[model samples]
Target: MIGIVYITAGSMENASEIARELVVRRLAACVNMFPTFSIYRWEEKVEEQNEIVLLVKTDSSRLDEIIGTVKHLHTYSLPAIEFWEVKGEEEYLDWVHVNSS
Candidate 1:
């Protein structure tokens, strides 16, 4: 199965670093990032901040390793990591599987 993982970083630099590591390790096929404003409750207080969001494409088999790598490299005490099953063009999905392997 293919998985699309989502993660947010405090800065573009951090996001790029994480993406590079993942791709280099073959844990992710590709990573797309963009800056956005995030509003959420933390420490019992609502806070809003600008953050970079990463969209990682990889194989489900490597999900655990990808998460661990992100945690190891992330700057956040508790980074937000989420994944969803995705269906798309067969060629694209196959590409993700081959690259992520």
Candidate 2:
């Protein structure tokens, strides 16, 4: 089965760098970027910020490696990294699994 991971980079440059590495290392089949506005509580204070959201596509087998790679390249002490299993059509999941390699 395949899955989709969501991660946010500290900046555009970092996002691009990580995306390239993921693809080169065969950790992800694709990485998409979109403008994002986030509002959340940090350090007991609510803050709003503009950021770039990365939609990462890869097989489940590569999940841990991909996460580790992101953590290593990420700037924040704690980066926003989350994954959601792809409960989609069979064909699509297979495609993700195939291309991720």
* Per-model tally of clashing residue pairs: 0, 0
lDDT by residue (12-83, candidate 2, tens digit) is: 998898889998898888999988888988899998888888999998889889989999998877888888
Report the backbone clash tally of model 1.
0
Q: Per-residue lDDT tens digits of candidate 1, residues 15-54?
A: 9999999999999999999999999999999999999999
TM-score of each: 0.98, 0.90
- Model 1, residue 94: distance off in Å is 0.2
| Ten contiguous residues with the weakest lDDT in model 1 | 58-67
lDDT of each: 0.96, 0.86
Best by lDDT: 1
**After superposing candidate 1, which stretches have Cα over 4 Å from the reference?**
none
